[model samples]
Target: MEQEANKKRKIIHIDMDAFYASVEQRDHPEYRGKPVIVGGSPNSRGVVATASYEARKFGVRSAMSSRRAVQLCPDGIFVYPRFDVYKDVSRHIREIFSRYTDLIEPLSLDEAYLDVSVDKQGIGSAIEIARLIKQAIKDELRLTASAGVSINKFVAKIASDMNKPDGLTFIGPSQITGFMEQLPVEKFHGVGKVTAEKMKKMGLHTGADLKRLSENEIKQYFGKPGAFYYRIVRGIDEREVQPHRETKSAGAEDTFPVDLTEIETLNKELERIGALVATRLKRHNLKGRTITLKIKYSDFKQITRNQSLPFATDDLEVIVKTAQQLLAAVDHEEKAIRLLGISLSNFGEVIAIHGNSTQLSLFD
Candidate 1:
């Protein structure tokens, strides 16, 4: 019974190397080990979505303007993204993951987490399983991937990124604190740009420095996020790996390919944004009680217009209609439009059981 209870829980994070470009190179044998860029067309005011290591050496990167990428490396090969093909490959990967455990939570097509505490294969060791998974991808897909094995998702994610392109790393529970001590504050999960800057300003540059501060002290300055920071600094995270629900608020905003001064262009852009919000809500089966319209002007100034609703419904029509009204209320003259977005929040889960509440609105 002691041995049964002592069975170590294992989790692995797998990240496909330069996923889009790698997929492209796989389908075309001639492109192997060569620089490849996958995204929109350069002629269509496109940007590089993913660049293989070869293209990366040439200064190509994701979200960089294709025009600039071409200037950076004229010899770089550019190919459009094939989402269908990527999805098919992803399906193959998920099949392999299912052989491990059902507690798989996919972050994206290229990354996912596997919980092996109750693995189907009875592979008692997580590291060995991770190594085998990596090998399987190489053999079956003719592609290289990397993995990180740890007890938790956050550290597992960090480990996977420690080494790239067919690399693997592990962090045992006893080594967690030391692993964090060497970790830079910027590398902490959930600590993004704004927080990193504040930490630096406070002279808290590394996990070791952050560990020196008490939770209360950090909370005194950063409020709720400060509390989160304190826990992560000490290499203590209570959050569990959740499955079946991609729990969190989500929204999409796009910076225009170019600035638009015309009201016609602006109106069209708003409609495009409205359509996007509708699609996401439909996919998540979540209805939100709040709608936010974010705008950025050519001068770099930004504004957000928000509306709260009496009820939450995952109805695209409702969100789109609210977004349209919000757009009509904004001032779009004099300055050109740089970006537009629509966000829906005050999210609540959808329950098919009639015993459950419909249009839940606890936050509202």
Candidate 2:
């Protein structure tokens, strides 16, 4: 019965095209069709939040440095992000989604996944539901959106990105295998650049190549995530569309422009990151008992250390001091640090009560 229910699940992934840049273009007629880059100034240490399609042609991308974006597209127009306006637009689109289904899980301000298996409008066809949602956004919001329809979230997400600015793609179960088999390994979800390169070196350039490996072989090569790849490559993803998902961890990390070898500079960076985490925890009215410090060397080697506190806290001092302690225990003098991160986890509500005790450990 559970298997039957899973077979009937209908999912849709909706993604706005160049959300920030599109909004800018829509609001100002002069910016339309021009290369608009929304982020901090090129002279500053800011990253590109979003780039218009015109700018994308010049190789500008999100998370890329604003200075690099300018170097790529010298004619690009840079504008500071107006998050207030973007949030308003996000709310409006979510309202539009509510008319069709209440089981909507927003990934960010620009994208979301909707389970339309049991839509409020009594719509039985998932494809039709997606079409209606996209058309509604076009009519009411005067903005275009791309959508993907499938039996599960993974396929739906990949399908949505198949076509560009305004696209609606539906992948039935029968079509899933062929679609996935031909897909480049790098295009698979969770396969980062490093993982993709590893796959290629192992002669697993595409899903078809990955399918040749047994589950045990994949597990031997990739660890726990290999189990996930094993299933997804065979068109099997049992994960559900969770609408009210709670964040299990809150943290911040920064990739420094230059590698730092000194402990003092590293501590200052950790302090800044710890404070950011504390502020987020307070804003969410949540306290965490575990503090984790993550470090990545210039050579891309990474390590994490975690410590559990006697009491849940959102205190900046506690977070900073705890992270600093964790940092002190690690042997950082051997390698220059390229990135540092601090995260608070094991939230108050979910953490196991240990009779008020603190535990500290080093994790490799």
Candidate 3:
């Protein structure tokens, strides 16, 4: 019965093509077919949010520094993001998705996962449902979307990116094994540049190579995530599409313009990062019992240290003090630090004390 249900599971991953840039082009006829870069000013310390296909041709990409984007594509038309407009568009797309299935999990404003195993529209085929959703978006919103249909989320997400703007690809159970085997290790979701380099060093360059390692051997080398890799390579992703998934964590990180070796400078940086996390916690009305400090060395090696407090807190002083304590335990003196980040997690209902008076918990 379990095997039958797994076989019957139908998932679809939808992603908008260069969402922000594409929206800009769609609204402005003059910008169509031209490079569009949506982000901060090139003169300031900002990064690219999204780049149009035309800008991508010049090697400009999201998360890249605006200064570098300009150097790569000098003629690129840079524009600030209009998040309000994007959110409105996202709501409209969600409305279209509701016509098919309510089991929709939004990954971001421009991407989502839909479990159309039993679509409300009475569609028996997931592929057909995906086509209808895409057609609806194009017809109603005048926007193009790419889709990937498969039996599981992992396969579906990978398949969706196989094609570009206005593309739809499906991976059936029979095709999953071969499709994953030929995929590069770097192409696997959650495998970053650092992990990919480590995988390559271990002679694991493709999904096939990863599948050869036993679960125990993979875990021994890569820890918990290794077990995940072992199963995913064999097309075993049992994770569900959660529509109302809670925010597991919220944090901020910044890559420095230059690596800092001085303890004083590192401490100052941590103070700023801690304050940012605290501000966000207050904004979201969240309190967390665990505080995590993340550090990346000049060589790109990263480490995270976490400390759990007796009670959840959103206090700036508490966050800063906890982060400082965690930083003290790390051997930062041995290496130059290129990045610093602080995050709070392990959230639950707890008494929130404000100005010496207890207030209602946000979770309540």
lDDT of 2 by residue, 1-364 (tens): 5335556999999999998899999999999999999875787545677899999999999767677789999999998766567777888999999998889898767899999989998978888988888898888877889999998899999999999789999888888889889999999998877678889999999999999999999999998889989888888888898898777898878888799988899887876576556534533446788999999999989999999999887666778889999989987668999989989888867322122122110000
Q: Which sections of candidate 2 miss by over 4 Å?
A: 1-5, 250-291, 296-302, 305-329, 333-364
Q: What is the lDDT of residue 211 in candidate 3?
A: 88
lDDT of 3 at 312: 82
Q: For every candidate structure, what is the RMSD over all alpha carbons to the true structure, in angstroms?
A: 8.6, 7.7, 6.9
The lowest-lDDT stretch of 10 consecutive residues in candidate 1 is 355-364
| Number of clashing residue pairs, candidate 3 | 0
Total clashing pairs for each candidate: 0, 0, 0
| lDDT of residue 349 for candidate 3 | 61
Q: What clash count does candidate 1 reach? A: 0
TM-score of each: 0.73, 0.79, 0.79
- Give each model's whole-structure lDDT: 0.75, 0.82, 0.82
lDDT of 1 at 1: 36
